[model samples]
Target: MTGWNADSIPDQHGRIAVVTGANSGLGLVTAAELARHGAHVVLAVRNTAAGAEAARRIGGDVEVRELDLARLDSVHAFATGLVSDHPVVDLLVNNAGVVLLGPRRTSADGFELQFATNMLGHFALTGLLLGALAAAPEARVVSLSSITHKSAHLDFDDLMSERGYRAPSAYGRSKLATTVFGVELDRRLRAARSPVISVLAHPGLTRTNLTPRAWEHRGRLGRVVARLGLLATQPVEQGTLPQLRAATAPGVRGGQFFGPAGLFETRGRVTEARLSREAADPAVGERLWAAAEELTGVSYL
Candidate 1:
């Protein structure tokens, strides 16, 4: 799809959307745009203060809700609250994630930081919200992956980075798991004959606070490197194209992946991007899905 832009997003009237990490970056832009198109957008973020600011900026039917993905308790509370208020969710964009950070950190649940926050949290969120998603006539779940996923491989024995951890490697592996889960969820939904759909999208290289924040704890050199890389990346607005397309584009199929079309998919019009053979491996996806169930204690069809 050449020349694809936000203008292509159809009217989202009467639809309800839940966007995680919508306080900033790609998630924020996506939520704002969806709200502009008349969708009742909920900004599910960890920091209620930041989320409120984000909602104020968007200025629509957007509401801020506390959702700390790293903590299973917070995840459950958020999901339960959302279900009670809105029985049906037309769109669930699992877009919140952490970037490559220095050293190994543990989530509130004691799992590796990247894998827990980026992959596991989203996994549980989707599963817990399955009922709400299925209640909608035609629901769509869009999971955000990354180009780095191409270089990642899942190591079940060390899913939590117990053996060793490299910042970039951990980030890639987490993203790979997210991509696999997205695809696997679609297959399960199809097998169950559900109207819900799952699709994946990548932001490519975009100028967001993720890299800067992740590298902040690494000292001066890390910040310098991150800033240099950001200079060559596209704006958050352009970076959000693929996911928005995956969320609303017509004729979009479950399991399809979308990304940029130019310069190794770093920046350009939205188009179908490539997925690594490893990411397409059904065994890996299935095993990861099972492991996620074990870790998050959340499961779905």
Candidate 2:
């Protein structure tokens, strides 16, 4: 198939999209593009001030709302409020996520901060809003994963990194869980004949605040890597293409994954990409799904 660009996105008039962390970076770009395409976009962020500023900058019918993914209560509140106000959600982008931080921190719900924000919170928010999503004729849920997920292993016993806190490893495991969740969700949706489509996408080494944040918490080596990433990384607007294609492409399927199409799958046009062997393991996916349900107390099936 040919590569996807912003122009290829269909007109989105009357559609409603909710993008987490829509204040900056790829999330901001995604929200802006969706709004530019005529969709009513909701910026679900942890900071109202930042979100409002971003909404203003986008210069569209974008609504800013507070949503702290580290807290389950906040996630629930955001979802409930959105569902109450909007009758249907055409797109839900689980874009807000943290990276390799210093220490292993727990969320408000006592879960690992990375896993909670990157995976469980999204899982719960999607589940809470599933009804609204299903109300739409064609709804799409796009979860952000990463190339680093290929090196991740789901350590059930050390999920919280209590054994030891390795920032990159923790982040990779969380993203891997997210990718697996997306694939498993697609399978369940197909079996149940659900109208909602679950898809996965990754931004290949994009220059964003996330990199700086990770480096800031790491040290000198991280700073060096961050600098290198800035030099070699793609623009945030370009980074958002994979998610946009997954959410908007007419030919996109439930289990499909999208990423950059350049060398080493690092930076280029948007195209369908292959999941790592570990990511596509059905048995591991099932176990992760069950664990996620138990951890988040949210279940779509």
Candidate 3:
């Protein structure tokens, strides 16, 4: 995988790919690239209008589906609708995520917004779509993770951040939960002898709408910081290479992680990434998996 880029993506003809939050930014680039390579891409987003606009921009064998990951009901509906339409789904890119919103918030199901959108919803969606994925010859479920997961720690006692709330900590913890889920899913798939594989990827410090939106409430200084920070990061096009590689690259294995090759994984070409010891712990995986199943009311494998 030396110096890998989107151009390295293999031909995806006859494959069906689902990319969440594909209206703009990295998700848009991913969906477009997949479609460009002859895959029928599904732009799974919350807003149908924006998704339709994105589909027009992509101009390929693509369709739009409303999927709001912040709500369990929406997640279930989106998965069911997609499965009903397409029984075999080849690739699922869990790419949608929210950043620190500067305050605590809850989803319709009363779970933390970041946790619900970033981890729990994706977890439930994957389970619901398992039948469709497994029916494919060799399906891949790519979970979007983050460098924040390397430093963040999980507090099982307050996984929902009920006692107190801090934006950065909450966002980091959500990413950590996502990382744990990806690895754990891979293990379960292997144990079950399922043909589907779970892979993880992170776009290191990419310029995206979520970053500026996350910092929008912090006044003038926040705007300045967001601008300066985005200037220092890679473009969304470059940022998407890791996940695209994870999704379509040849020889990628289950449980493998892909990220930038730059210092601290901030920017560069795609390469193998390291997982935190905490994220690699089997005990933590089991605990988080159980919590996710209970919270989302979804179970599989």
Candidate 4:
């Protein structure tokens, strides 16, 4: 729907939702909308203060919990605490991510920061929380991807970007991996006759702090671009539509990719978008799945 808004969200009373990086940007908007619809939302964030403020701003039954997607230990701890507190999770939104700047930087576990936080950490957290998710009547996992994924290539040999580093390419690769994982997870869930739905979505060029913070240290030119881009970009609330649709729409199916229907899939109304050749590659997906499991030491199947 071209004019889709958060008001269209279905009633989510008694539902439980976990949104990563819900403190700001698209994640914040997503969490707020869910809470508005009567769902008990858990804001999984790295910054406790900001997350608490976001929860307060949402003005609902929102709970702020500590979660650092850049660290495996933090992911594990968050999962454990969530499981203990809430036995079933109706929705899990893998929305936390990072777009690194300049040279290569490694995560706590020595993996590429973008890949580690955007893909591996979510993988581990989802795997660890699968039980809670499956316990719900109709659980769903919405993986946040991006339009940039179409131009991405997964360099298996140099997955950590140790060979070379380009910020945009690295970010794109991580998002592509996330999309592939969503598709593969759907396949496995169907094959195993599971009760969970794995869906993917992208916020087409929404104005957010991600870009500015990512390119913050890149000098005056970078700052100018960030400022101008924000002015030209759609609001974060509108940008979250595709994701909210994928997570809660009645017609949304497993393995479907959603994005803005506007110009070049960059800005406009939410719709079912086409997948790239790389995203639909089963062999590549399986390979990535195996590699991810090996890297994170967490397996869903």
Q: Using lDDT as the measure, which candidate wins?
A: 3
lDDT of 3 by residue, 1-301 (tens): 5867777888999999999989999899999999999999999999999999999999999999999999889999999899999999999999998886667999999999999999999999999999999999999999999999999999999999987799789999999999999999999999999999999999999988887876766899988988888777998999999999999988889999999999799998888999999999999999999999999999999
- TM-scores of the models, in the order given: 0.97, 0.97, 0.98, 0.97
In terms of TM-score, which candidate is strongest? 3
lDDT of 1 by residue, 33-142 (tens): 99988899999999999999999999989889999999999999999999999999999999999876567889989999889988999999999999999999989999
Clashes counted in candidate 3 amount to 0
lDDT of the candidates, in the order given? 0.92, 0.89, 0.94, 0.91
Clashes of each: 0, 0, 0, 0
lDDT of 4 at 260: 90
Off by over 4 Å in 2: 216-222
* Candidate 1 positional error at 279, Å: 1.0
> What does candidate 2's lDDT look like per residue over 1-301, in tens digits?
5756988889989999999999999999999999999999999999999998999899878999999999989988998889999979999999999875677889999988898899999989988998999999999999999998888899987777778788778899899989998998888888889999999999897888887766855678877877876888899889899999998888788999999989777899887788989889889888888888888888877
Ordered list by lDDT, greatest first: 3, 1, 4, 2
- Residue pairs in clash, model 4: none
Give me candidate 3's TM-score against the actual structure.
0.98
RMSD, each candidate, Å?
1.2, 1.3, 0.9, 1.1
